[model samples]
Target: MTFSLVARDSGTGAFGIVISSSSPAVASRCAHARAGVGVVASQNVTNPALGTLVLDALAGELDAEAALKAVLAQEKFPDYRQLTVVDANGSTAVHSGPNSLGVHTHLEGEAAVAAGNLLADESVIAELLGGYAGSTAKAFEDRLLDGLRAALAAGGEAGPVHSAGMLVVEDVPWPVTDLRVDHSDDPIGELAALWALWQPQKNDYRVRGVDPTRAPSYGVPGDQ
Candidate 1:
């Protein structure tokens, strides 16, 4: 009961994953990415460990397809999982297991790949892939949001998607963007709004971590 996309930003070499699902906290278990490595999404009776395996292989310098193949080869029940990977170079790969739940399909485009199961229709993944391809957003996060919105517009999951999330990793070891809407009637929209509100502080959070001297002070009352 999930749909997701993994993409690499050509301009900045960032990796991002955007996902939504009928289940709650999908991102917590399905989406994974690492700075300067790659992005991976694992669903359809997800084994969560598979996501980490893909990222680990990518960090070892494997290409998108190679990483997925290596990880999937070890899966005891590969036929029950759906996975997608995008490497730092923008190469993409996807796997939809034979036993994936409900109507499931996937599509790939330059630097991006999308997959969905238990979808409203086959058109859902195509719309998400096309939307990301057509987006002009300078930021990977915005582009991902565009893709998720497109999926929703095209009749997202078979039921209401209660959780939505965006994950992005830039040059830093930590995620520059990691936002989730655990339970919402409109999780995708809520995720977008949260991104907007978080945009200005994205860099600030990083600065606080690596260079507190240059970090802006928190405006909250306790800092005085």
Candidate 2:
């Protein structure tokens, strides 16, 4: 019911993940990531714990493959879950539930991982992976979102997608930015619109570069 892509920006060293699901608030449960740490997307019979466990393993000095392997090794029902891991060094790996509706596969590349269950077609995942691999930008967040957007454009999850999210963290206390569109009839469109709200400038004010807590100084020193 969920599809996701996780990748590290080759140029900025930033890591991020983008996700969408037919389930409401899917992101709150399906995605987990830490900047400079690692990224994990656990869904379709999600272990939930795997999300944090994978992050800890990578952050605690384990490689991506090792971290993912350890998680798979201990799963009592690995055949029912799908997961992706991307370590601090940009290494990527993925595993899909063997029982996943007959069309799941992992697509791994330079600094990214794309995987899904109950997809419209395997080509959707391939298209997403290709988008990530071909990205030339410096922001992993953007790349991840672009991958998901591409997948959505190609037709997502087998069914309708209601919730979507983009998550990225830094050394900062919280995620640099965490955006979610819950229960939207058109989640992808909602997500794109949300990104535009955070885009650099509009109305002579900018949401970019300013702290979320800072009030924007819109007009001028002398206003009507």
Candidate 3:
């Protein structure tokens, strides 16, 4: 019911995740990332806590594979979960539980990893990785979104995806980009539109959080 990609941008050292699912608000549960740490996508049976646990391990200076291993080791039902991790060094790791849904698969590539369950075919994972890797010239967030779009074009999940989202973390303690289309007929398109609207203001919002005096006003009411 879900497909996701976790990746690190080699050019900017940013980490990002893009996800879509038949379930509403899928990314709220599946996407996780921390600045200077790593990114995690925990899906399948959808234990949202696994995202936090794996991120915690990554924050503890564990590598991607080691972080995933540490979290799964403590999980009571590891066989029902699917997880992907990409650490700060661009190392990637993935786990597909034995009890994963139909046509489930995962792939790891240079600086990126992709996983999907209830997929139209396993090839979706490969296309996702290729899409991100092939778009090295684009901005980091666009590359991540390209991967999600490519997976959908290559045959995404077994059913129509209703929700889609993207998360990106840079040097700050908070996400620089967090966009979601919680429920929609074309969630990816909606998410992309949101990204377009957010991109120019992303850095401004970060500045607002850290130093409001240096932040640019959006010319909205009361902002002046």
Candidate 4:
């Protein structure tokens, strides 16, 4: 029901995840990333907790493979979940439970990993990784968006995807880009548009968080 890509930007030390699914609000549950840490996508049975577990382990100095193994060691239903992780060093790990939903597959690429359950075919995962590889020169968020678009073109989910999300973390503790299109007819396109709109203001939002005194006006009603 879901297809996702987790990747690291070698040029910028950024981490990001792009996901789309037949399920509503898929990103809220399946994608997770922390600045200077790693990225994780937990799908299939969709245990949001696993995303945190993996990130926490990575934050605790575990490599991607070690972090995933640590989480699976405690995961009671490992056979029912599909997981992928990419660490700050661009190392990756993935696990697909034997009981994962139909036609599940996962693959690894340079500084990236991808997984999907109930997908149209293996082409979906291939295109996802391929897109990331081809678009390394693009902005981190745009590279992810291109991967999601390629997933759609390759075949996408077995069913119509209702939600899409992109999460990207850069030098800050917070996400540089976090966009979700829950229950949209065309979630990927909606997410792409949101990224475009957020591009100019991305830094400003971070500024507001890190230093309100240096932040600019909100450009809304009360500003004089």
Candidate 5:
């Protein structure tokens, strides 16, 4: 129902995801990210807990493989889940089950993990991973968009992408800037444009030294 990408920026330590899905409000349900912790994409049979729990495990300095093992160790039916996790340290883990639909598969690497079930092909995962990992950029948002675009080009979600969203939580989280498409015929394109609008505003706050990305620092630009 969704084709999404999550990425980490090596330069700024930012994390973000861009996604388009045929399902309603896919971003809210399918994409989860925590800056300096980890990202979890839970699909097919979505498990939101995987997002928070996986990030907790990652922040505890667990390796990707070990963290994933521990998370699944608690699940009653692990094989029913399709999940991908990437730690702040760039370790990755993915699970695509044998019982999943025909094209189901997952690929994990140092900086990225991708998984798709009921997809056009298993190769979609690798394509999404390669796009994000190889995109050497300073901006987390751009890297994430690259991943989404790649997934779309690789035959997205076996259907048209409808909704999109992006999130990156730094030490602070006021301006929030959690861009969401809500719904769109071309969600990726719409999300890219929305991000363009958001960047200048973000920089405006930055240049005036208004620091909104931090949770407690969003005060008048110069008076503080």
Candidate 6:
């Protein structure tokens, strides 16, 4: 019921995840990333807490493979969940449980991993990775979005997707980009539009967070 890609940008030291699903607000549960840490996509049976669990392990200095293994070691129902992790060093790891839904599969590429369950076919994973990898010249966020688009084009989930999202974390303590289309007939398209509107202002928001005096005006009523 879900498909996702998690990636680390070696050049910028950023991590991101792009995800979509037949379920509503899929990303809110599946996508997770932390600045200077790593990114995780926890879907399939959808143990949302696993995202945080993996991140915590990464924060504790575990690499991608170690972090994922540590989490699965403690998870009560590991067989029902699918997880992907990409660390700050561009190392990647993925686990698709034996109990995962129809046509499920996962793939690891340079600095990235793609995973899905209840997908239209196994090729979706390869297409997602290929799309992201082929767009190395693009912005990290755009590459992630491209991956999601490619997976959908190759054939997404077994059913129509209703929600989609992208999460990115850079040098700040919070996400630099977090865009979601909670429920839509064309969630990925809506998400892409939101990214277009947000891209130019992304750095501005980060500046506002770290130093308000140096930040630009909000362009609202109170400023002179």
TM-score of each: 0.98, 0.86, 0.97, 0.97, 0.81, 0.98
Residue pairs with backbone atoms closer than 3 Å in model 6 (clashes)? none
Clashes per candidate (backbone, < 3 Å): 0, 1, 0, 0, 4, 0
Which window of ten consecutive residues has the lowest lDDT sum in model 2?
A: 201-210
- lDDT (0-100) at residue 81 of candidate 5? 76
Estimate candidate 5's alpha-carbon lDDT, on a 0 to 1 scale. Answer: 0.71
Badly placed stretches (over 4 Å) of model 6 are none
Off by over 4 Å in 4: none
For model 3, name the residue pairs that clash: none
* Candidate 4 lDDT tens digits, 89-159: 99999999999999999999999998899999988999998987887546888888888899999999988
What is residue 132's positional error in candidate 4, in angstroms?
Answer: 1.5
lDDT of 3 by residue, 176-219 (tens): 99999999999999999999999888888999999988989889
The better-scoring model by TM-score among 3 and 5 is 3
Q: Pairs clashing in candidate 2?
A: 120-158
Candidate 2 lDDT, tens digit per residue, 127-158? 89887677675555566667888898887888
TM-score of predicted model 5? 0.81
**C-alpha-based local distance difference test score of model 6:** 0.94
Off by over 4 Å in 3: none
Question: Which residue ranges in model 2 land beyond 4 Å of their true spot?
Answer: 136-139, 201-224
Q: How close is candidate 3 to the true structure, as a TM-score?
A: 0.97
Candidate 6 or 2, higher TM-score: 6
Best by lDDT: 6
